[model samples]
Target: MENLPKKVRSKKLSTRVDLTAMVSVSFLLIIFFMVTIELAKPKAIDFNLPDNEWTYRGTHISCGPDVTRIVTILLDDNNKIITYSGLLFTPIVDPKVLNYGKNGIRQELFDRRKNITEYSTAIGKPKNGPIVIIKPSKKSNFKNLVDILDEMAIANIDTYAIVSDFTPEESKLLALK
Candidate 1:
């Protein structure tokens, strides 16, 4: 090859890379993480099923975190307690409300406690502890509802829930909380 003389001649040049594919991949990874992380996380209260001889029946009511006793209460159309599953039981009894203030509700609560004990004994898991689920009808009066709640509290129930169907109009009723 022959060498040529250069008279201080030079040129400036640059190159650019297309990062569209990399950005697309990064977006896909972000979406995957968001979708999975949102579902995998546990919420304020994780519900767990307790070992109970339950029959397939009316609506189920669950409360509190997983791995604990959760009482399930079933109410009849007449706004009376038909059956309640917990520490106390009245054995397929039609629980009537006297609404005679403290003494009346207390007596009913005592009967509930006795039933629970008897059933627990029959099932060979005798524990005199109190865990009740009060299933009152939507038409039940506030006084009756409060009375049941008070009785449950008096029975030493720290955790329970008032089960009811959610309606659009009733959604605003959340203010009662």
Candidate 2:
């Protein structure tokens, strides 16, 4: 019997794959994600802080803020809020207990804003809104403070400050049964 010649086989290619493109693509994706994360970072709120020292008539002098349009809100525990316009001693709108929401504090704020605008216009001044000063006592919760801030935003109040320092008179007023 004649033996048949064995067929020659083609050389087998390497099964291992080159990872250069995959590594480069992965690195590029990582860099893109990092850049996007940096761009998505939150920005800080810009605040215009008043000058600590005031110079008056070529001399440094103490000056008091005009309290006419200033509305002070005292926050107490159990969702109690006492609001008054101007200084406590000589208040434009006497202190009155108010609740949260539209019919309560929101309405008061709207009325005050209207009154203040009219008063300013009558006095030959630009129509200015009220400057609210929120005084949140230690007893007041964070939720109450947030709620008040929401109200301020809802009322479109531009000028307002959260003051923690409570005067003796204000503390006494809050203590009233």
- Top model number, lDDT: 2
| Worst 10-residue lDDT window, candidate 2 | 48-57
Local distance difference test, each candidate: 0.51, 0.84
Q: Give the worst 10-residue stretch by lDDT in candidate 1.
A: 168-177
Give the lDDT of residue 171 in candidate 1: 32
TM-score winner among the candidates?
A: 2
Residue-level error in angstroms, candidate 1, position 104? 1.9
Pairs with steric clashes in candidate 1: 88-116, 89-115, 89-116
Q: What lDDT, from 0 to 1, does candidate 1 have?
A: 0.51
- Name the TM-score of candidate 2: 0.68
Please identify model 1 stretches exceeding 4 Å from their true place: 1-49, 54-91, 128-131, 138-144, 165-177
Writing each residue's lDDT as its tens digit, candidate 1 over 1-177 gives 357776786675656778999999999999999999999998775422344443223333354321123344543333344333322222244323344345555566666567655755765667533355565656566766776776776765545567776434223322221
**lDDT by residue for model 2 over 1-177, one digit each (tens)?**
369888899999999999999999999999999999999999876543332333333465456444566799999999999999988998888999999999989999998888877866765655456778999999999999999999998998777889999999999999992
